[model samples]
Target: EPEVTQTPSHQVTQMGQEVILRCVPISNHLYFYWYRQILGQKVEFLVSFYNNEISEKSEIFDDQFSVERPDGSNFTLKIRSTKLEDSAMYFCASTGLRGLRNSPLHFGNGTRLTVT
Candidate 1:
């Protein structure tokens, strides 16, 4: 079975620095998303992308954050300036079907970003 792959399983950065998290989803999947979980917080949806454009985004995805698919296979999330609040485990997910009830999302193990 195909799965999502994330690079640099762990990252440590100073506050106010920039960070880019990368992911490669299963080849056949259509919908892609980025989600995050702070150390003691719930998993929150950050943004969703489809057809090379942002489909939906949460309040957390503000001007400081951006996502792109530099290549058809890789998806990346870039934080222009990191804050202490930005420290969290970021997950990449993809689903072939549209609705949540129709298909379950396949998620990567996550890239843990630590801001100091």
Candidate 2:
């Protein structure tokens, strides 16, 4: 199985600040996604990207969030003017073309964002 990796395992930012969370998904994966888990809350899906565009996004991925595939190896999630409620463990995940059943989502350890 391939691996997904995330950077800056932890981040601290004040409210209304911008922070870009970074990840490097498996090399050949065709789908990518971002999900988050607030303290004591269930993991929530944020966005999914494919073929260079956003394939789907949840309402929580409002104007405050953006995602990008700046290069072949990196996928990123950017939170703008983050609010205290944005504090969560942001995860980056990817899967192969066969879809979820054949290619179960591979997730990174996650970047813990603390918005104070």
Per-residue lDDT tens digits for candidate 1, residues 1-116, read 78899987999999999999999998878889999999999999999998899999999999999999888899999999999999999999999755655898899999999999
lDDT of 2: 0.95
Residue pairs of candidate 1 with colliding backbone atoms: none
Candidate 1, which segments miss by more than 4 Å at Cα?
97-101
TM-score of each: 0.95, 0.95
Candidate 1 least-lDDT 10 residues: 96-105
Candidate 2, residue 63: the lDDT equals 94
Q: Candidate 1: deviation at residue 111, Å? A: 0.4
CA lDDT, candidate 2, residue 85: 94
lDDT (CA) for every model shown?
A: 0.94, 0.95
